[model samples]
Target: MALTGKLEIDVEIKAPPDKFHDMFCNRPHHSQHACNDKIKGCDLHDGDWGTVGSVIFWSYVRDGKAKTLKEVVEAIDSEKNSITFRVLEGDVMKDFKSYVITIQASPKSGGEGSIVHWTMEYEKQHEGIAHPEDALQFAVEISKDIDSHLTQGN
Candidate 1:
């Protein structure tokens, strides 16, 4: 089996695409209010929000255990509504040699909803580590939570 792998998942959300993209680019910390069970909090470590090279720390739960991840904003494309985060330090580093996460929100044609695409690229330290299916599921769940929060006027 290959030690390096990539997972991509696309989910349909009821929220606006620009709003979803702005949340991650400008105010990721606010997601805690909507998906606190999965993502506890996000803190700015360096640089300013919505800028490349900014560092952010994330607290979350995985497999019923709390974990933390520190990452730097690697790239951002406003026209494409995408942001990429390169993992710097965290539990994932223990198992994976490298990890990158990219999220993109594309507005549906002539519709009020959006299709959110989440991609995870990683190289495992060894073959013993399983694929990050849980992480992908978590992202989809969080997207759904945010959609629900927005549609409910919360």
Candidate 2:
């Protein structure tokens, strides 16, 4: 099996695309409010939110286990409503040599919703480790939670 892999997942949400994009880019620290069960909190370590080169720390749960990640905002494109994060430190580094997560939101055609796409790219430390399906699932679940939270106006 190849040591490097990429995973992509698309989610359809009933919330506005701009709102979703803004959440990830401008107020990621508030994600816990949308999915408290999965995300404990996110804190700004350096720089400002919604800008490239900013450092952010995440506290979250995966497979019932608590974990943390420190990531730097690698890119942000308002025109595409996309944000990319490069993992700088975390448990993920133990199994993967490098990891990058990119999320994009686009308005649904003829609708009042959006299509959210999450892409994860990583290189495994060795061939024995399995693909990061669990991580993709985590992103999907968080997307759903955020959708629900926004649709319910909570």
Candidate 3:
């Protein structure tokens, strides 16, 4: 079955989209704080931090055990302030046949603030499996957290 979902959250940022894009795309910076209380280690490989195509490895503690995920950049549009990525390898893959996530940031039309759209697409191993909303929610929450933290200083 094909699965798709999206989440939208408005966050005020002190800096413009350029700065916001840099911070959001920067994997190392994100790796550091990306961890929820359950997360353990996060790492990025290939080129520098946020360059397109770089791979990210994130390990987290769930149910008293460690699990990891590997994802790679699938597309990035700086002019449009959007980035799309897909899971190259990870625990989630065991259940899902395919998974992709995208984030778009656009300056609010005729306004000082900006809007962010997070999208997730996945296919499950079984026809009855649920769409990956929970995974998408994690990304949305962390992204909003970053946006909110940066906005407060502005």
Every candidate's CA RMSD: 1.3, 1.1, 3.2
Per-residue lDDT tens digits for candidate 1, residues 27-132, read 8998888898889989999999999999999999888999999999999999999999999999999999999999999998888899999999999999999998
Better of 1 and 2 by lDDT: 2
In angstroms, give how far residue 13 of model 1 lies from its true place: 0.2
TM-score of each: 0.95, 0.97, 0.76
Candidate number that wins on TM-score, 1 or 2: 2
Per-residue lDDT for 1-154 in model 2, tens only? 9999999999999998889999999999888999999999899999999999999999998888999999999999999999999999998999999999999999998888999999999999999999999887788899999999888943
Better of 1 and 3 by TM-score: 1
Number of the top candidate by TM-score? 2
Better of 2 and 3 by lDDT: 2
Worst 10 residues of 2 by lDDT: 145-154
Clashing pairs in 1: none
Measured on C-alpha atoms, candidate 3 has an lDDT of 0.67
Question: What's the TM for model 2?
Answer: 0.97
Q: Which stretches of candidate 2 lie over 4 Å from their true place?
A: none
lDDT of 3 at 58: 75
